[model samples]
Target: MAKKKQTLFECQHCGEQSVKWLGKCPSCGGWDSFIELNQAEQESLKYLSKQTSSDKQKAMPITKIEEDDVVRFSSNNTEFDLVMGGGIVPGSLTLIGGSPGVGKSTLLLKIAGNLAKSGKKVLYVSGEESAGQIKLRATRLDANEENLYLLPEISLEAIQNEMLRENYEAVIIDSIQTMYSDKLTSAPGSVTQVREITFELMRKAKESRIAMFIIGHITKDGSIAGPRVLEHMVDTVLYFEGEQSKEIRMLRGFKNRFGSTSEIGIFEMTANGLESAKNISNRFFSSSKEQSGSCLTVTAEGSRALILEVQALVSHSTNPNPKRSATGFDTNRLNMLLALLEKKLDLPLNSYDVFINISGGIKIKESSCDLAVIASIISSFRNRPISRESVLIGEVSLTGEIKDVFSMETRLREAISCGIKKAIISTKPKGIVGIKCFEVDEVSKMLELF
Candidate 1:
């Protein structure tokens, strides 16, 4: 007698597994995201997991592993190479994700062209665009190299066949969502198919010891569209974030196995191609005279400190419940700051509508920006501007006390390099030569600013 196959349901949003179908996932609260997976897939997953576990268990002494050096290859782009942790490691799978027209494709093409021109064999595979479409963009970017081979096929078998045909140094699969497997009945970008396809590519990359750069599509929620495991499977994950209307793009490493994550690469999109951004520290602020409701602060993006303009708008709320909104800044942090202002500073802020935004689409999460945020709000409420050439750097306590932050001196120096003269800090340091650092202990003392 044949055994009955068992099936399981997996949530598409959070990859939660369940024995039975659920209207809403108990783990992630996602509605109708569960997909059916037969017993075959479950067994396959177990087999793969066992194989991986066995390899890890066979690990030798740590000193023996450190004796060997990893093979690293540079794509010849400084900014790209820096974000990639010195260079790309062979047998590594990297996923680069970004919104449409944010230059994910462009950046990969440029890297491919550069590698091929430097006598390295590269295969550029595109499932979404034809050879002609890639060629047009390459021509515009002046990226015509003899060793840069282009394949506009989507079949996994065809791609695998090409991999077997030659020992290519690097392979790029543009937009992994467009590739499909014949064994899967679901669509190409479906959760099951994505998992299967990534597994195959990862296995192939490891066996061949070839570096693979796979482009991934982003969901409406700004996360990489696919199973959550897709990110975990890859060796490195990079996010290219920027405004579509603006030319400045920033590439940051969310996960890197080779090097530190405290590195960020900045790029500017020009008509030709993406170029390394110059003077990134000062480019985020406007040039005109300083205005009310806008304050300057320095926040660290990886190791680099940038001068950002924190803008706030406070107006009388017509509704009984005031509206609060924040962009590029945490809304919860804004609310907390507002409550502190009302309780400790004696400001009736709950009755007004407040909005806060960081310039240049740069998200500010450092607690050190708290002083700048509060100052911006107060400036807007009083219709007064602070000192023009000063930058605020401190963490605001819940009791409205100003607290010192890490790397306060580093932030102040960056501001000085951008021609800023004054830095209002929480605690006085040993002091630097160029910028004037003023230490303030409470938020009330800041109300006397011009």
Candidate 2:
């Protein structure tokens, strides 16, 4: 008698398997995430586990390993090279993810073209778009180079074959989710297929010393789609973040084995392609006359300081409980600020609707912007405008005391370089040649600005 075929339902969100269909994934708590897939036998799964031994052999003494053989190449994109901690390391797997149409492909294509121009044999592979389509885009971006090659294929075996035939220095897989292998019976984007494909590419990249760039699709929650295992297997993980409708985009390094994760690359999207955003500080500040509900602040993106505009709108709430909303800022922190305003600052915020926004689509993760947020909210509540020339820089504590922020001089210098005149800081700052500085010891003193 023939052996019975087995089937299992797997959660695409978390890669959990179940004998029966589940309405929601027990592992990841995602609704209706289970997908029925035919199980290939254990013998067939061996291909995914097979490893090559070109680079890693028996463990040797740490000092014996050769360091001069390691190679790094610049893609010729200044901001891209900076965020990547100098340049792309050879034989490394980098996964770049973003929402649909956030310039992930465009940025890679531009890099591929640049690498090709530098006499590095490069192959541009696209599983989603055809060669003709990519050619059209290359022409539009003016990235058509003599050495740049294109391979619009999806099968992993075919891609490897092409790589072996051409011996290219760099290769770009337009997306990892679209690649499939004959070893796995699941769908192309299923957890098994994504994991297997990533493993194959990673091993091949290590063996051949090829700089590999894998474009990944992001889920609705802004995480790279497919199994989280994909992120762990890669050497570097980058995310392109910004509003789709906006002109600016931020390339952030989420995980970097060779560099600092705090580094950020800013880009401006134009009709030609993505260019380095050099004067981004001016972009965040509006040109219109200063008004209430808006305040200026300086933030640090890694080592670089950026001048930002913090805006808030406070009004009487129609509902029983006032609504609190924040964009590009943490909602919980905003709520804490509101409570602090009520208790410590004696502001009646219980019956008001608070809306806060960090202008220019730049998300503020640093706590140094806390005082500036409070100042903007209070400015809106009191209907008084803050001097555009003045910038608030400090952290606000729950006890309502102002706290000093790191790199105070860097933040203020960025503000002064942008032609700002005054700074509202917690501790007294020194060497402020062009700008005037004022020290505010408590949250209550911030109210005296208006």
Candidate 3:
């Protein structure tokens, strides 16, 4: 006698399984999410089918295999290479997430052009744009690749069939949310569908030893859309972050299994294409002078170091309560810092309206930007202009003490490369030669230097 199969309703919004149907899923707390799926069909295959003559697998010994011996495909761009460590590793799946019109497709297209130039076959699968539309954009980007193939389709099974037939060096999927499989009844972009499709792609990438690039959609909160586990399934997760209004788009590496996770690739959006910004420090600060209420700071993102500008303005408020506003920085953190200043230093903030802005439209969350935030607020209060070449890099404690941050050497090196002579750091930074370094333990001590 055959074994009996189980039955349950699955949540479409959160992929939860339920024994009984309810208006809302108990596991995910979502309404009307339960969808019935065949129990036997829903269960993933426990073991791989026996390989016939047609299905061959790579055979290797655990000890005999050398990771360093694996061949790497260079994207042929220095900045991109840095972000991807040495180069693209084989059998790696990378997910690129960003907002709409953040140059996700443009950057990937440029990479495809570069890979094709080096005599590598590239396959670009676009579900969001037509082949003709991609072609026009590629032409504008000056992409003349004879080996690049473009296919406009959203069927996952069809894409898998094509992958089995072609021998491409690199494969790029425009957006993962649009792709779906017929095996699942869920609609495209649904939680069940997105999770299932990404898992299938991961399996394909591993089995074929092919490097795949997946572009993902971001939620309204600026995080990647789909289940939270989607980020963990990929070998590399990159977030293309920057203000929509600014031309600068920062490619930050949130996770990298093949390389360091602290790397960032800087690119500037141009009419022709996305150009790599080499002098990141100069590019961020060269346009600004000794302006009042503006503060310069060196911050770190993963393995990459950066110099950022922090600006604050204080004005008299007509309302009984003063207004506080901040951009690219945390508003609550600003308020806490203000409270610290008011209670500890007895500064005047209740009567004055305070506003803070991080120049270049880049959002900073690292505590290293704390010193710069304080300096900017003080500059506004005193109506003083911080030196144009001066830069601050440190973290601030709740008790008004300066704290040391990580990668001090790297941050200082980046600042020095751009001709920044002075840096206010939490501790004495080492490994950087021939530069002025001021070590301060408290934020108030910084007021005298300014």
Candidate 4:
């Protein structure tokens, strides 16, 4: 046999590499990321075989490629399907990231059961959990997946070989960080190993037209497992965002190539498994029972809109600066809103300890929550109650102006569906069907409406 040959390239970011023409990269997603290094080498047969491994690697005109019409798979939980933009696309790759004990594996196992029940072949490759452990959890979930297959393996080559031997319809790789390839000298979870393993799976997925769901661990900074490029290589990215202590879990799709990325799914975690909440709007507003400093807000996640409750408590501060804390939302954003409240309306937030919460243990990032945040603070300071039937959606500017938000139409419709009669939005009333509407450009004007 001839000697093996190798070619190298410089990483655009760190100037270290041994590959060429990688968009973004295994290390980073920086654009035009690879620079080839010319080297004298004999034409090799093995390297050529590796390059010709998949039909998806063939060159084709962009116009000739058909965008796969998006399809939905029954996630067993309607809410999960909604978050997945109707359903999981065939041959698509999904990366689900979350903290430990946040139920990442459990959620995927539940989905595997659903897929297997729907007459699809599902292979669950567990690099973290044991075969018996998954079965025990499956028993608790009451899942009936006679077609589901389980493989407790961490080696990438073994999984790839097994995949080629069968005609599985779907695959789930539990925790990508744990899986490794023997071809790479780097240890598993290292930058090189993660990249190699992911590429192997990607090649397999694209060639087989089988969708793959890979669960990932979150770093201390709450980023998905492995280098950020793992997300760029995948077709869709999802995050299971919610507090573990709370029964409510929010599944958010941050990116989707086959469907809308703006969708969100709401589920309540029960001892059995995640169950879909049909009347999510009603569930959000049900907690508002004449509670002081509690207000309703309409926010949009992906394509789906929702009404969420914002709760605030203002107490006399023993600390000179007062404690400004918030949960299920950004604390820095909360502080800026407080500053705007004080500057625009002369609210005495400096003397009070302000705490804000997005009820139901779900995080809200939409700027539309600005109005509700302001209203909650005011209500808490005044010890007053906000109208239970009213909801607010707007963004607060640094100069105390309430700005127009994206997807106002969707937000308004969600409010209406939730039985909200009055809405305070920042735009001029444009005659949306149903419900009373008030518009204000600045927070000062909004204060007058309340």
What would you estimate as the lDDT of candidate 2? Answer: 0.88
lDDT of 4 at 123: 94
Tens-place lDDT per residue, model 4, 292-381, is: 789998877767777788999999988887998898788999999988888888887888899998877767766778888899888888
In model 4, how large is the Cα lDDT of residue 155? 96
> lDDT: which is higher, 2 or 4?
2
Per-structure clash totals for the candidates: 0, 0, 2, 6
Taken over the whole model, the C-alpha lDDT of each candidate is 0.86, 0.88, 0.82, 0.78
lDDT of 3 at 429: 62
lDDT of 3: 0.82
Output the worst ten-in-a-row residue range by lDDT, candidate 2. 41-50
Give lDDT tens digits, candidate 3, residues 1-450: 998766677676556767678898776577887877664336531221221133456777999987555677799877777888779987889999999999999999999999988988888999999999999999999887998889899999989888888887788999999998887666788776787778888888888787889999897777788777788778999889877788899888888888887778889888888898866766666544687888888888766787888889988778888999999899988898888778766778888899998878877878888888888888889888888788888878888899999989988888888778888887876567867998889866776776
TM-score (C-alpha, index-matched) for candidate 3: 0.87
Prediction 4 TM-score vs. true: 0.82
Query: Candidate 2 residues 31-97, lDDT tens each?
Result: 9998876656233444444543344568889899887465678989889998888899999999999
Clashing residue pairs in candidate 4 (N, C-alpha, C atoms within 3 angstroms): 72-87, 73-87, 262-302, 262-303, 263-302, 263-303
lDDT, candidate 1, 299-355, per-residue tens: 986667889999999998888999999999999989999999888778899889999
